[model samples]
Target: MTGIDPAVRHLTRTAAQMRKKKPMRIMLLAHSYWPEHSPPQRRWTTLIREFRKAGWDIDVVTPVAHFPQGRRRLPRSEAGTPFRGQRGPFGERIKRVPYLRHSGNRHAARLVDQVFSAAMSIPTALMWRKADVVIATAPSLPILVAGYLVARLRGVPLVVEMRDAWPDLARDARLVKGQVKSVVERVVEAIQRRADLVVTVTDGFAQTLRARGVKNVVTVTNGLDLEAVQLLEAPPAERDKLEVLYLGNHGESQRLDVIVKASALVGGDLMHLHMVGHGTRRPDLLKLAGALNAPVTFHPPLYGADLIARYRSADTCVVSLRDDWKSFETTIPSKTYEVLAIGRHMTAIVRGEAARIVTEAGGGDVVAWKPEAVAELWAELARDRGRLTAGLSGRDWVKANADFRQLAVQYMGHLSDLVVAGRSRP
Candidate 1:
């Protein structure tokens, strides 16, 4: 008995044929792009670059840069005149759409940025010509709306890639309410329905979209680029003490307080939790660590090779998703993949699909966002070094399956089929 899903088998066969004849020509629209330093931007970079390598002529429509580094990427300056345009390594054109500001904690600020980026994309995509396909990547749902309209105008097929679910996620988080949120959700749903193909990051999310009436959805798990990750050397373990590292943003959604509480509960050389990253909640988390006298170390963001090396210092990698159920179906922290790439056992203190990934990958253990549970797990792992080492077998599982190369190939195959179908249509 062949265990492959029929839909996937068919799509795979179709994509293989499309690749041999001619590579795809694709225009990807996202609010952020490479060097902006967000997980979504990182994912797009890997996929787009891989597609370009496979002979896809790619063009990325994105906003002017400014992100996790907290600095505006100045337009390239040559002598006195600024270099207004730059193309990606594989000759993919980069079209910078004007945007208002960087990320923000305030809804108004976030809306302003999202709207500006989307508005800028309208002209950007309209003026960009000769692409066989357009992919609207999301979280900024406005981009999907713009992609759909542009594709409709150009008579091209529009593919929507959902990185996060919108208004409902916002509603569940109590970020907004009343008529406006209701309206935004309806708009998002309409766009989802209109897209010819929808790419979801997880099966759980796809299921949610299905229940909400979205059709033609496919799951593409977030994965690590082991090629780049290999540049990082695993650090030598320091001692008998367990070093649990949490890498990525220290924002509110992480529910890091639980980790702090858990550490306080354990309170010994047996456990040490290090959080490495910058976020709005860092100061508060730092203060809480001090007040609680938890054995927590805070480090600033590290980039690429350096970041990987820094992460190697830990015996186990840790990630915490928000305790909010609203987050379960909508988000999967990309750090989980990074942890696997680094060959570290993961300790995820949250719920939903991420927990499932950890469990299935044999990557690590999952516990509810409870101090006692987290502490118990920490103590158990800390006492059992051999177990932690054995648990890292999941890293091998991820490398073979969830690594970026495999993911990129899958994505390009899907995009190729969409392009072929678009080209075939009357």
Candidate 2:
């Protein structure tokens, strides 16, 4: 409330009115939820609330979870546990399903988690009432299975939102091979083919789906929640020293070996590099930091009230993606949108949509994924401090166009079409 502009109040009210007519009974099913060190939950927090204000009833079905480390965290916020004292900004209902926690990067663990999630979810979906639409996200494909079953029982359309191109990710990551991968791949492939509509977060991913011959697919790129991002304002007391931040999962996909080497080249004391969040490669990165003698700090991911202030305080944020062919076409990491909103300059040692967005905004720099390139970019950023001041410019562009409210409007319209098509059937 403190930072919300009075002018936007009218727009919020208008969006709410349109939201009231044919309000959606949306059930978002995902493996990760709030407090899980994931961006989707935070985005969904704003998303669900906005739907509620617009007069829709929103419900979230997610696991009682922890992420990256696979540790189950306590639910201690005022909202309490989802089944009991759940409350938030927009008064949406939250339902938590029992799920097993395990590392996503390890092949054995991935199988275990996926199987367990699918098993637990089958019976768990019975706990909720039938909804108009069932929206499912993937990492563990069980949520899609859960949605399919629920949608079949309720006779509703199923929206499979693919956040990651799984089994593909597993294949790309070399987690499986030959007949084993083939059989599991077919299972996932069949799911995507059968979905009423398959939604992908990137155009590159959408192409992958089209090539596979799936119809009714759409691209809804992960976006900044403008209301939440705009609510963030610069903090008063930034240190004289530069604060370069790497926020989000630190995993193999980031090619952190170069990041660690670049940190060594920069000499940690001159600029502070803060890595926040947990991922498969965190321990290795920490070990690399020790060997390189870099000035780096690590912290757990922020949640609830802490998120806003962290953005306000960041001087510059960094995002890294490993150079790979499939990666370029398959993924747009969530941090890309978060850093854009922080109103800070961003540096990406990545290619694909992530770098394109940064360059188009004229906000930051993109370097080849190499140690020398990373070193050069860091040196360049260090020399041109004034350029950092303009980094927030991209954020302005995002506020006007790439906001979630606009995306939600488009998504709702798409859902209405699907609903109409369903009514016409047989």
Please, what are the lDDT tens digits per residue for candidate 1 over residues 1-426? 299856446546644654576876788888777656787778878877767666778887877775643336555431111113557655777887666664554556766777877887877778877588888888777788888888888878889988776646766766657887788778888888888999988887888888988888898888877767652344343366788888887876687888988888988578888888888788899999999999888887778667766666777788788776575645678887777666677787757777777787877788778889989988887766665652445666666667776688788778767777766778
Full-model lDDT for every candidate = 0.74, 0.71
Q: Model 2: clashing residue pairs?
A: 268-295
Instruction: State the lDDT of candidate 2 residue by residue for 1-426, as single tens digits.
Output: 568865356457656656657776887777776655466675566566556766777777766665555656564563134344254457766676555557555657756765676666556656677678888888667677887887777788899988776757767776668898787788778889899999888887788888988898998777877656553444233344556778777776676778778767877545677887777788888998998888788888776567666666666778887777475546777777767776667778777777788788765778788878777777666666665664467777676656787666667667767877887999
Candidate whose lDDT is highest: 1
Q: For residue 32, what is the lDDT in candidate 2?
A: 71
- Lowest-lDDT window of 10 residues in candidate 2? 78-87
lDDT of the structure predicted as candidate 1: 0.74
RMSD values, in order shown: 4.2, 4.1
